[model samples]
Target: MTAEPALRLVDAAHPAASAEGVAPAREQERPETAGAQTLRRGLAVLRLLTRVGPGGLRMGEIGHRLGLNKTTAIRLTRTLVDEGFVLHDRAAGRYRLGPEAFAVGLAAEPSYELQRQAAGMLRALAAESGDTVFFTVLHGHESICLSRDEGDFPIRNQLIKPGDRWPLGVGAGSCAILAALPDDVVADVLARNAALRAEKFPRCTDASVLSLVRDTRERGYCLQPGMVFEDSWAIGVVVYDANEAPVASISIAALRSRLGPARSAMLGNRLMQASKELTAQLKA
Candidate 1:
């Protein structure tokens, strides 16, 4: 065969062969593959660490909460530590989030902007209402307090603060997000966290959960009057993200004596206004 003639023939037949530099599109992801499963479990570990706060969790506790066996949890945590996604304390035998995980969270440029917006709004609301205003974000079935601003209230709520977390229906901001969820999602969350509520928060009942959802939808905001504790109350509104999802909430919590019907209405209006302003900024 003549080499030059064969080359010409092949190029003619496959004219785009020289354009092989162009990359093909990535394949669509499937649900149940091993890689997907591993990613899910790894993310679960990170989320667990995030919820456990600075104290972190022991390997045994991590396994118990995640339902992983000792050997499997060891392998999973080792991989996370190797990748800098987790930090293992040799002396304490506790596992916590590492710097790399914070790097990943900080890279969420939009959440930074969201926090800025929230900080200003929280400060304003706390000042205007003379109550403690909290910034909370939804994490799975719970809400984590990202930040809070305290007003000059003579008595402040000792309930929620930065780094504290509660189940969805437990706190004002948490219930705000929970109530803003679509009906089915609200129901699912209630069902999913029923056991947790019964164990940790014995006061919250299914009837009350339904009532909060109903009242929030009807009233167009969230109110948890003495739900978490007697002589304590809170009101909130959900703040939507750019995706128009209820990713977080802002609320004002106060002593019941300070947040009666008249004061509640006044603070509720302020809280809703702040929520709207923050939502607009975030979705922008």
Candidate 2:
């Protein structure tokens, strides 16, 4: 038995292979199959529609944005349209998410029930603060605006809207969520999101964001001091789950003049209260 060992094949170029002829634990990923590629492209189209809101995008624009040829885009979109996931507006020559899309989204609504729970609170906070209030949720390493409410303030910070997405820590609510994370996890998040943040949000350096995190922890809230836009300012607090894990954030955006030191602190307190109430509601 010691004299006869079974033959094993190993790729010489694979560095992970052992000297004793053991195979490597990992292999290079194979290319996606045609069917898989087509499915991925279709999903990309759907995601694009979600980001663009109700107006929708023209076929040509979709192709251009996705870097697909006209024929390929047309074929993919036509297939989706036939499947009822997308609808084509004959008059406008644009494609929008169809009833089937809404039906599908409804199936996943339970995961986003927080939006429903926070709707009244967001509106109330907006009215009380006389500014725009936003409810944002952590989606992977990014933050997405799930709902927005506007107050009677003549001036509005229109920089963000529902369906908008940003790298974690780029905005007030987002910063609050990031700040709530454990230090080691925050480091990981920053490392993973660094490239995207640099490409999309040049102003959000790691040092600056870490400073904001420290300040957020000290003050019990986050203050985005006109970083994204010179005139736009916001205050935010993190909402936690039953286990005290950060899940989302509530923020108020106003003009820089409206968010001076005194008012910023006051609004931050209000947001913290809302965060606590929302967290309790989710637990209940």
Give the candidate number with the greatest TM-score: 2
lDDT for each residue of candidate 1 in 140-254, tens digit (9 for 90 to 100): 8878777878777655554554656677887677888998888888888888777766755666778897898788888878778876666667888888887888888888877
| Collision pairs in model 1 | none
lDDT of 2 by residue, 1-284 (tens): 01222322223345354222111111122598999888878987887787677889999999987789999999999999999999999899999999899999999989898889999999999889878898889888878888878787765555665666777888899999999999998998888777656655566779989999999999999999966555678898999987898989999988788998999999999889888998899889
* The candidate that achieves the highest lDDT relative to the unseen native structure: 2
Candidate 1 ranges with C-alpha deviation above 4 Å: 1-105, 108-112
TM-score of 2: 0.82
Instruction: Estimate TM-scores for all models.
Output: 0.65, 0.82
Q: Which pairs of residues clash in candidate 2, taking residues 3 or more apart in a chain or in different chains?
A: none
Q: Candidate 1's C-alpha lDDT?
A: 0.74
> Candidate 2 — which residues are off by over 4 angstroms?
1-40, 51-55, 64-68
